[model samples]
Target: MNNRTGAIESVAGNSNFAVNSALSFGYRWFDPERWGHWSFDLDFFGSYMGVGVSGFGMSDHENLGFLGMRGRVGYRVWHDRLEPFIGMIGGSVLANTASGGVDHGAVWGYWFSPTGGVRYYIPNTRWSISLDGFFRFIGGVNGLSGPGVTINEAPHAGLGGRWLYEPVGIVALGYRF
Candidate 1:
């Protein structure tokens, strides 16, 4: 339940938000029956983005992406009309980057992320809303160009900015069965 992580495209003229487009897919498994308001979860998420690049070899653009899986423990309060939950997620993170086109070669690494989020569930319905965020700590790598920022940053580098450890935010719609 969140926005995809990657470089944000900045396009000229109309279609302003198009520059910020990202493709993301995720799956989550949860226990519907809470054990004393606590639940267990298994989650998987992935994202990809490519944008036009300039001043980098003869490459047309840069591509970056990541895939991750995490286990979570959560606690819910007020299980009736409005349910609020808080959870912590931890897992392995894999990221890869292709800069200055595919010919420049791609660099990748394994990393891990610790995340927490709050979710609101509406009663009598299977739909829910969530806002989650996490920090990406690249394994032993430091410093990356925009494309390298994600996995090295693990899909947390959305813009052309420098960061030691990158942060990501996710606001997405979810369904519970």
Candidate 2:
């Protein structure tokens, strides 16, 4: 499950929240006898970020969607039932702005996140639960311009040209095989 939620505070001093859901699949490999409690994982995910409502007080116009993959390294502790992990994610996104139900042109961009999480495995079952958090960085590279908002009457965007930062939290249920 890729359902996530988070808060956004804009330069205009407006704070709002966003929600997104996705489907994901992953593979984990661990060899406790040889590698202690270390593990490696790779996951692929796709999600729809929903309509863009500018936290900066601008009118909502864009619908954003993304598809991404993550790679993680983890260390297990406490009878091998608890694991803490760190990972990185990279993906492509599509943003489209519309007015009056008329479709506008779509712009493509790239996004990345530096993520970490903890997972707890059930004592007697191949099941687990996790809580993950990350800060996502987004930027438009093609045909999408203009600052998202302004602060002190000055334009404020992300790093490296035009960028946006979003913080997210996720709670997930999992199965291990």
Candidate 3:
């Protein structure tokens, strides 16, 4: 069983509450009936993330948004009943915040993610459930974090993770058309 727990992000001793989520639309690229056991898909995705910090009687809140596209390759091993897939996602994110009555405009950064998941179609319905996991690889703290270089970058090799894993994954219910 896979699980995920939400937590705050810590950077250079500064920590803030961060919430991450995504919404996507996808289309199968190849004719499933003709492909026989393998399928390809293209997806357009968007994500939302909120970060908040409070200390010294001052509070700063931020809303981060992301948009991207993904390409997926999947294989059906059990009569189209069970499928396992992997995909690549590329996108950009906007980080906007307000601090002590001052507003900072949105900052942008590019990112790439490699994801894997398993899907199971319910008995005889078009509805399916999937458990997906991915590790986002941010190029660098290019914008969003101010002019200063990012103190902590992606591919963290800390005790907790090298790449963001479970408890950080997404589960979705989808319909095949």
Candidate 4:
């Protein structure tokens, strides 16, 4: 009976994890301006994540998902064709979970994340794209779960990193206000 239960649990968990992974994506907008020949940017983005747990005797462990929103303000150190910029980011993650036999289950919680990253912009065009990376510190109450409940687990508070893909790397495309 125990073996059968474990097998059922394993199959259920994998299925949930797959669903979560398929739904992950991030979207953002930004606005940059030049002052004293230095460019400043304000940007915002939303992210969705799904994580699975595997590594213990526990087959009934839960799967996690998060909906996150972030805002950043940055300065361009170099303003040439390949512009390099430094910036600070602040955001919150709305964590949730999916568990318990094909049912979409969730618990609510919030975490604050701070991050920094560099962006490289392609030169000369109101339509340019950039790649940015950042880290976040997560915290809050949405990490715990009860029986038949799915909760989004926060990553250990501290440093984290992400890759940001800007469709139009141009400053005009990402307007702050």
Candidate 5:
């Protein structure tokens, strides 16, 4: 009887350990709890032409460039295997073009982008991938003139939505801490 009781206790202990380990890993990955509901995300991304013309229709505008730093603060709206989130982001786009022996200089613009997305947590694991899209309202391109040129000389302030990429998409890896 004594030996049987000891064996039962040992099995129970091992089962508890396995359960705890699984729970810890899940929390680290999914982070479904509401106690620490705030999350910060950092991402690097590139954009393709959602709109606009390039090079007199010779080619699509080269939209490949550093997308700059993007930071977002999100509250966990719903937490499950797939977590859906809403957040706000701000970043800049620096674009340069060279054509016909002349470097067209750089255009810098700031944007206020509101984002929403969902993260799919892998089954029984702490690894997850997310897809996010943002509608970016960019402004403040007030004084963009080409090299060796003046605003009056260019005859345009370069303001307005000179570049367009609606619903920018991003994929990211994240872990719960």
Candidate 6:
């Protein structure tokens, strides 16, 4: 979430967190045992962003959805039960609405995040869990324009700032075949 509001009227202070839900499908290329304890994966995912979760103190409960893809490389350690990885994800916003603060326009843009994490595979099973952290960069196409609106007079560039930054956390459950 970009902290610098560009022109949107409704003001919501900048916070360090965002709420979202996502699911990912991926394929691993090789067995670590045969590849010197290193593995690589490519994944495609979709997520729904839940802004203003409770709207407890805000005026609007806004939200959106997006799809993205990422690639990760991990190195196994501790008997191959734990692996650490680094990756990058990029995507575009696919949907939005015309209600509530700052983003009450047809918002579309691109975003990317650089991430790092660790995965723990359960013994004797293909199940695994991961925890990751990332910082995302989001930018709009010509600063939030919609029908009957011009970039110069668009109702406050959605989300204000031409670009925004968000620090995000992710937890994922995985299954390998």
Off by over 4 Å in 2: 1-15, 52-61, 98-104, 145-160
Residue-by-residue lDDT tens digits, candidate 2, 72-172: 99999999999999999879887766432334567677788999999999999999999988887777545543334221122236443446667878888
Local error of candidate 6 at 53, Å? Answer: 7.2
Descending-lDDT candidate ranking: 2, 6, 3, 1, 5, 4
Task: List the lowest-lDDT window of 10 residues for candidate 5.
Answer: 15-24
Clashing pairs in 6: 2-164, 6-160, 6-161
Runs in model 3 deviating more than 4 A are 1-17, 29-33, 97-104, 140-168
Off by over 4 Å in 6: 1-16, 53-58, 95-103, 141-161
Candidate 3 lDDT tens digits, 83-164: 8999888787665766543455566656677889998879878898999888765543333333332322454445663332
Displacement of residue 80 (Cα, Å) in model 4 is 2.1
Give candidate 1 regions above 4 Å deviation: 1-34, 49-62, 80-104, 140-164
TM, every model: 0.55, 0.73, 0.69, 0.47, 0.49, 0.73
| Winning candidate number (lDDT) | 2
Better of 5 and 6 by lDDT: 6
Model 3 earns a TM-score of 0.69
C-alpha root-mean-square deviation, candidate 3: 8.3
Per-residue accuracy of model 4 over 1-177 as CA lDDT, tens digit each: 135244343233243323222121233333444243345444345445545544333333333333444445445555533444555544444544433423344444444444444455545544444555444444554435655443334434333532211111112222112
Model 6, range 117-163, lDDT digits (tens) per residue? 99999999999999988876765634444444333232233467445
Model 4 regions more than 4 Å off: 1-34, 51-79, 99-105, 148-177
Q: Measured by TM-score, how close is model 2 to the native structure?
A: 0.73
Each candidate structure's count of clashing pairs: 7, 0, 2, 7, 0, 3
